[model samples]
Target: MARATGIRGIWHSLPLERYTSRDNYIWLVVATVCIGAFMAAVDASIVNVALPDLSTYFHASASLVSWVLIAYLLTLATLLTLFGRLADMMGRRPLYTFGFLVFIIGSAACGAAINLPMLIVSRVFQAAGAAMLQANSVAIITATVPASVRGRAIGFQGSAQAIGLSLGPAIGGGLIGLFGWRAIFYVNVPVGLIGTLMAAAILPKDKLSGHKTTFDWWGTALMTPFLVLLMMALTEGNSWGWTSPTILGMFAASGLLLVGFIFRELSFRAPLVDMRLFKIWVFSVGNFTGLLSYLAMFGVLFLMPFFFERVLTFNSAVTGLILTAVPLGMTVAAPKAGAMADRYGPRLLTTSGMALTGLASLLLAWTLSLHPSVVMMVIELVLVGVGLGVFTPPNNSSVMGSLPSSRLGVGGGILNMARSLGMAMGTALSGTIMAVVLIAHGGVEKAGGPKGPWIPSTRYSLYVLVALSLLAALLSLFRVAEKDSSKHESMPLEW
Candidate 1:
């Protein structure tokens, strides 16, 4: 049946009670998921301005102090697949609820920490919860929605996340100014408590039995250590040099370990991650590009504030306003892109969106002379933002649309897991490259960091960002697959 006909049936054919009941339930569920998502995303951006404050509190070196953030990101990265698989086994509600509680405790602990090590330990707890929440949010949404409107549901989820992210920096900056860095962590506790309460009330209490969930424990065990070590190597390797015994040793271990994990998954009866999914070019290519997109996007994110504040000499408020260009562009363009993709196809949009991002990155890199018109720079960043807005939904729709409905949970899990891993790698890669290049070019002394002769590394980092964007564009080209026609109108290339 055609989508219009199908939608009409769903709306008009069903009794009013059916539609009303579902709407009430879905709205509550969406609210619960948004709470969880906001918690995760808010923290992700909130800490951007707090690193300096943390260093003073710990009386630690700036480089050492940075580990607080790095550790959290690495822990989040290493555990996404683990918890995502667990969500597949246990159920989203239990994991999601537990995540909020864990996050709350972690935040409280962070606010009270006495030193760097203690704070870092608390960060790990926070990360564990974030990983659980982040991995399951989309899976739950996808599982709950009907096939015909899955794209709209996913798009809404993405929009919520993007909105939350856009708010984070502003919230973080405002709190730090009013209270302190401790306030950043303190803020999560009350919000989390309310969310937890609402979720427990609104969510239904039923779960699918994962009779064979443990079938692929070997893959889990292998992938976890591989990512943990790999991110460690990437984030620290440049400072240590990739060829250093420590770096090379970790790299070798990660490679060997992941290879074994892949082989095990392929042979396992109930794989943790289905290796055969790769046989479908759409899933395979979509996953591949998803990783690269984060690599570029987060690299820009990791550095842009620094560029705005340190390089351009803007204050926190101005820096945030400038940074808003990225999300703002996405906000304005995404709905239109989704509408367009509904008419044509996702192929061109996916490919062109990435191409635009690469072009934007190139423009950004070329203009990093610290004297470019701020307005022009913001506009360029907006272009990259719009490109991402265009890319995410259609691509997500295509990938999910092509898969069987039963696998939406695992498939969603995998896609998000890939995204989290990409973010972790991007954070580490961008950090390491900036640190290494700055040290090589002018040393910490020349970099003139915002705080007293600090390392001004954001300029060099733009190169890394540009390179990652170019690579993302290349990967985006491989995600050309058609959605199931039975589901909706064929999406356009630009959409």
Candidate 2:
């Protein structure tokens, strides 16, 4: 009893609010949040490079081993909004801190796993923790930071994520080569522990609402299954056959659940997601464009590995190194773009960014047949990265800025959910399109494996991505002006 009381006292005393001024303290919060962002993003991609190793180690089939990745994504996508709602009701500090702890434990479990199922389940657990961190990282920043610097703060977080994602493959490859696949999971342990302690020490206390609200169990129940089913269909549509009864049933069921979730949120007193938030043009259009941006970005990312390995005949190491150019460009540009957005509105930056990305995609497609020089290829990818870097932070700031402070949590949740959905959809659609194009040219067996129709199929996929990028650019043009978002800021919160 005495020990437990002492631990509680220590926890309470950990907050650094007494030592730091408001101005200085917010940046510390941003830095701490960046750790979570970095760790979560790193985990998302790091596991990819380890999948073949995992298969060999566990003696599992490719399909079964893939669940290790899929389960994490599925769980993360399904629970993001729910956890975001919980953060609003409970407190961001507690949820975010506990997220680090959960992630640490999950990482340890993954490292110590005896079999594939254990590792997969551990990944699901890790993703739950990641969902908590991601859902609140933006909300906490918005709630704590001044509007003037909010874009810059979010930009830092975006850069951390991009850097982590960019480095994951290289890091995973090195770690696995030196220490084996388990090292990838174990690496998270120390980082997560430090992040957990930092969060407890520096994060501001959550400001609880004055009034009590009921938890939206029905909304959660409906939304979770809906997302799970929807993501499953998207992730496995190609493998399962898009027209298969099982895929069709999952899609149909997900659609029904989505309708039910919408109806429930509209009618319920305290909804999981405030459906009315979408009524704000910035919030709605920002989210839509954000989804398209990721779709376009990830579609290119999904296709590039195939292009590098099969068409260019590059080794994995060379491909990974070349791919780093995209995120490197993003890392360089995101902070500057974010700062620019604060001075000038997101409209010009976002529109220009997507236009740049579309133009890059168009160039890549146009140059594919010409066999563009490696330098040219890297430059084009870097431009795409720069475009995404410029677009994300300002767009995120705009979406969060448009919301009442109270709705920031769920708002962030929806924003992240859109990103996850976009990634899943991007990979699925691009792969499906490439396969279809290949089939149209000749069967896969006859197409001669990456040498035959693959280049043309890839070019067609890039054209599709270019179209999506243009559409996102068009949508960005419609974003409500910054001043207009402020008008809606004080709207009463239904929850």
Candidate 3:
């Protein structure tokens, strides 16, 4: 099939293909990738509800309970850059296939966990699999599809993830209510098996790069300890005291390792991540802006459910239903925003989206005094949902389009890695802040009783999120070209 063409005559942002006997199987690939992406995204949301269940199951302290989440996030964070490098070394197909298998194993272990430590360990394994899948899916799709249709393909793929994430609470709550917490883990088994089989059949086999690259063993070595230490410090610092030897040591070591990793990447021949990608104005600004934006967006998601159930006095099911607006709005708006970015440019859509996102954050902050009304909450959340729907696709397009085709594999990997880090940092940071604030306010008793301190803590967190969103808007403004500038001006990706 002759590929579709757009005005600039360079083809659309990505490739396209006509369905053929040989190509009928492409849908299988789409299904496979989408399923994996959806699973990873949904798990993030699903587990939020399961934490209490897990806490009870293990009879652990709040600090230990929190590690159930922190451990998974830290592991995923530590592995993403490494996994991206590994995919560059090994074929994406094999790595992608193996990811699903690993995920299945992790899920089973989680379902059958005998103790809290075991569950956290299982989650670590699951996170490893998730990183592998996330870093490779976009690269795989870009490789298989013609660029003419790439935006649509990626848009739909992202949409699946959005829907899955939106529905996660509903699914997890429903499964947990009916069957038990174990159902959440068991749910992934069939999907993992199917996705594994399809990926093996559709994705072409290829060998790891034979070029004698060393994989930046030093970069990988330092990064893990850096993230683990940082997250551990953040999670435990309040309990241990910021000045406590343990917290101070972790903080100090994390700083040293991070600085060491940065110097190592800049000096390495083939760095684990191409540090030079930071030099591209769009790539740099877009990623930082997006990261901060995710910090706010997911911070809200992580904290809101607690507010809904405890302060506002709603049930878990209702919280899930109300939160549904975010994903729903994203599902509605992403493709349209993507299409507009395709026609107009990423500048308007992304900046405007983020600006609106800031507005939503402000709305929540403004309304903190009032009791949570489902209607008001839904409306504010809808704005957030719409803003995210608008912001993500265009920003993603700009970042991904800025790269050359050859680098798509690694570039896509790095992009997702940044997102994962932001997500982990967001939830962990907010959780830690919420805990500290509540304790400081009146030793957790003033916040609330058995209900929760969600109102006070969430309100404070929203203020922080609002500031972050505004910063994101400013970053987007700086990065995106003015309407009069030539956005498509040829620039080498060799920076």
User: Which candidate number maximizes lDDT?
Assistant: 2
Regions of model 1 farther than 4 Å from truth: 1-26, 52-67, 87-91, 138-156, 207-212, 370-372, 445-457, 483-495
Candidate 2 TM-score versus the reference: 0.82
* lDDT pick, better of 1 and 3: 3
Ranking by lDDT: 2, 3, 1
Error of 1 at 283 (Å): 1.6
Tell me the lDDT of candidate 1: 0.72
Report the lDDT tens digits of candidate 2 across residue range 1-495.
999999999887768766355658889999999999999998877765565456557765333455676677667777887787688678999999999999999999999999988998899899999999988898899988999999799878877888898897777767776788899899999999999989999998888985565788898899878876876676566657889999999999999999999999999887877888888889899998898888887677667766665567664456657767766777788879878999999999999999998999888887774255888888998999899889988998899888876676678778888887676566566766776676577535121244657678889989999999999999998887646455666766744
Task: Count steric clashes of candidate 3.
Answer: 8
lDDT of each: 0.72, 0.80, 0.74
- After superposition of all CA atoms, the RMSD between model 1 and the true structure is 8.8
Candidate 1 lDDT, 1-495, residue by residue in tens: 699898666533322343337656776667778888878887876676565456456664344555676677767766777887677667777788789899999999988988888998999999899888888787777767677777676666677778877777677767776787789899999999997766555555435874656646677789878887877787677657778999999999999998999889877776777776666678777877778777677677666665555466665555656666776777787788878888877888888887788788778776776467777888888998898888877777777776765566567767876777776676677777766766666545122444321234665666666666666667766665654533322321110
On the 0 to 100 scale, the lDDT of residue 308 in model 2 is 66
lDDT of 3 by residue, 1-495 (tens): 234434334322112232223655556567778988999888877876665556556765344566766777667766876776677677677788889999999999989988888888999999889888887787778777778888778767877788788898888777877788889999999989988866766665454557643567887898888988998898778778989999999999999999999999888876767787776678788888778767777777777766665566555566667777777777788879988988878877888887887788778766754364567778888898788889888888788777655556556667776777777777777777777776766534222354434466677877788788887877777665434213334433332
Query: Which numbered prediction scores highest in TM-score against the true structure?
Result: 3
